[model samples]
Target: MNFVYEKMMGGKKGLTGFLILATLILVIFPLFLDIFRLNLVGKYLTYAFPAVSLVLLWGYGGILSLGQGVFFGLGGYGMAMFLKLEASSVENTKIQSTPGIPDFMDWNQLTSLPWFWEPFNSLTLTILAILILPAAFAYIIGAAMFKRRVGGVYFAIITQVIAVILTILIVGQQGYTGGINGITDLRTLNGWDITTDSAKYIFYFINVALLLGVILLSRLILTSKFGSLLLAIRDKEDRVRFSGYDVSNFKIFIFCFSALISSIGGAMFTLQVGFMSPSFVGIVPSIEMVIFAAVGGRMSLIGAVYGTLLINFGKTAFSESFPELWLFLMGGLFISVVMFFPNGLAGLWDDYGHYITDRFSKSKKTKEDSPEIVEKKSDESAA
Candidate 1:
């Protein structure tokens, strides 16, 4: 969809979105859902962060990154490291050979903490790493690819390979990263036990708050001239270059921004889910992230959140009831959505909903006018 910046991405439309999200977060979900279900929605909202970024990158910037999982993993593991350090205090690990180190490290026969893990002992440093590491990695990747005009399928392939490589590295380094199991047993953030239901409730609100901020940020960007430039680059990169814009710089910026968004989601995921695993940092999950954006309406920021919720809800429902058919069903949904509704749920609504609403309004107006017309006719006949 070629989105008109003024029409779709403007602050007015974003305000409507903000109100809807605020209502859902502050009123609807809290009042309607039990804690368990609310937490599940929180998990779904976390994925929406990355999905919104994908809408920026793929839908507007025309950059399809298949390695978003790597950034997500980096952010998640960054947070996980700090949480693990807190959980593995000397008192907690008194039975371990290395009482001050993480239990997994002790299990693997390590005597001292790895140098890389040292920084994570500080929460401030961990938060900084979570933000910087992903953006730095994205900068390198985007600079290398966009500068050389490598994009589309080739860029996508490279990203997919990167995801696979990172997954292998994390899984292979058992002693360092907890291997295929990834980071687990995270108990607390500071002194507050994050595993408690109360904590989950708090984190859910936090997730919603951050996600809303991101949506507003994205809307601000998309409504700006730079957003038009991105759309132009997506449709006509060579023309944009001919027009004297630094296309590669814009690409790099969007790439880094997308990474930042994905990382934030990852960090929030770790907080809510209580674990960060290699399973989330791989090709399958990375692609699934894109599917969330596509299913929502790649050009619609607010639509992405609803899309993630609906898809995840369906996945959870189907997988629990008919495990064997869930994959087939999900695959079919993806295929059918792409094939039949290229613009996704938002597109469908825009196309048919306006027509329905217009018809309803016209009918109601005619009904009101009929009473006035009949009253005038009776007065004229009496005269």
Candidate 2:
């Protein structure tokens, strides 16, 4: 058990952190928050998927991608295609000129389902698309850039540009891609109504489970030989390449893996939010995701979740009363984190948490060595 804990959980500290986060999300939040608030938290948790991926790719692997939203949107659109089809049954949309297709397509005068969207009519195919499309897209990008030794700021800029281009494409192809409004009014999944309160609870739990699973998988990768190589590549790529390692392959693999993780989040977002939009597929949300990682301690997976929740909660709260100021507030918050708390909340804890622990330990020792306690022990021994 100890060996397993050490290997899988990073020993006691890691295990404790995982358990605490699990308790907070899985138990405490559900017990305290009403269903509506819990649902919002679930949405925030979905965003954490990308944040966690950023932690792995940017924090650990030293690969900063500024367009994770691209993969996220692909996954979301895949699931949305399935749900939209389910909701647009011949019976449901008989009034439209083109029955059995998404309303948006009918509104655009599309007479038939697009060839690409045909695959999403099946739940099985939709699931596969959600899982496969993002990784494949990421592999192509990573291979192109990493193979040519193009990285750092240049790679970041390329990713941002791709995000912009993809958003423009989605917005321009109104008949096919749902345009700027995005794939909306998603209603069910494989015959199950996903908008009911009960469904919300179930989906929230599922999201939590998937997130925990992703974190564990990421942790496992971090503790393995591959993880060490990732760090080596991040720190000294030329040296690793000199050591006979195919550096680009490692970079490509992690990039693909991170894209896959983000896509899972996107799928869950569609399930929970009942829609997917091009708004989430742009450079802004992608950068906000990075801020989540940065504020949560990019080096810490669990911290990513907290960072996501904190920032999103702030956005919601601030937007309620001062909507115009929220963006500026967020920008300021990001700047503060970067300038003053670069390591993020996790770094602050690392810097200060031990002081509390030390105080408790010292008090316990003082009690154990107190004169009265020592005299009592001596008396007991003599007796």
Candidate 3:
């Protein structure tokens, strides 16, 4: 048990992993990739948040909530609300009958902002809502489900339903939620134009920094006693429960934590991508996000980021060259990952990598022992 824990925790191997991740996100990509490609990578990196969170929930805790998109959308919409409000300032919306409100509101024949959007006017509150709202929603769902012992596929189905309901609500309420198009035409954030190349670069670094912070936090959790409990719950819920741990509380906490992480990504996506739409708040995107986690290795948090980047990169390349084949390729990739590499790219690396390392060590030792063995044989012959 100690050996397993040491291997999983931040020993030499973990430090090497962290260093590789840091070098890629902080140094290599920024130095080599162009501004356009870098920004695109930034967008892909945003998806990594949910992927990493899914690793914690599914790989460790065995709780698969398929409605992560709902939380992601909620977080994006929270930030989008603030940015949209700023963009719809009196000067920007002078042509509208209700100049200060969102243009969508004016188009829908509304005169003022809704009660809910009023709170987003404050930046601090918007930030808080980005984290709090999704966690709160997750808490409600998780509490209800886990407390009732309704888990596995049932919890997944309920979460999917929640995602569908959110998409419908956003699309149905065009005036308030920006409808099918989502909140667009966002130019500036806090009076600084975010549409410029310089701002994109700034936001990219900010996104990378936040991602690293999340990775570190997740590492802390996985190395702690709580992480052990989560693993126990995933493997043997009955045993843990009999051991006196509130398994439901851990589930709720992890679910909410995953929601909060995903929301932060969504908020960053709005800032970098400059839009928030119902397209992301649906079942399809949520499932794809899970694929991202699965492809990365549900057990490896850093692998989640690489998995998202690789998948998105493949998507862009395929969609550009063979638009019709993109979906087929993606479906095939998902199927292959599940069928062949259930633990993902990370698992493959751990398997073959350790094997190769062991072989090399054995060869080196044999070489070193050859001289000593020959010397011993020479002495016996002399005797």
Candidate with best lDDT: 2
The TM-score ranking, best first, is: 2, 3, 1
lDDT of 1 by residue, 1-383 (tens): 23534434453334445566679776899999999999999999999998999999998999998888889889999999999999999999999988989888899999999999999999999999999999999999999999999999999999999999999998888999999888899989999999899999999999999998898789779877989999999999999999998999999999999999999999999999999999999999899899999998999888788779879988998899989999898888888988998998778766765565567678887886897887997999999
Worst 10 residues of 2 by lDDT: 352-361
By lDDT, the candidates rank as 2, 3, 1
TM-score (C-alpha) between model 2 and the true structure: 0.92
Clashes of 2: 0
In terms of TM-score, the best-performing candidate is 2
Q: What is the lDDT of residue 255 in candidate 2?
A: 98
Candidate 2: the clashing residue pairs are none
Evaluate residue 300 in candidate 2 and report its C-alpha lDDT on the 0 to 100 scale.
Answer: 92
Error of 2 at 319 (Å): 0.9
Give one digit per residue, the lDDT tens place, for model 2 in 293-327. Answer: 99999999988998999899989988987888988
The C-alpha stretches of model 3 lying farther than 4 A from their native spots are 1-9, 352-383
- Whole-structure CA lDDT of model 2: 0.93
Pairs that collide in candidate 3 are none
The global Cα lDDT (0 to 1) of model 1 is: 0.89
Total clashes for model 1: 0
lDDT per residue as tens, model 3, 1-383:
55433534466456556677889988999999999999999999999999999999998999987999998899999999999999998998999888999988999999989999999999999999998999999999998899999999999999999999999999999989989999998888899999999999999999999998898789888888999999999999999999998899999999999999999999999999999999998999899888899898999898898889988998998899989999899778778887998888888767765565566678887986898887997899999
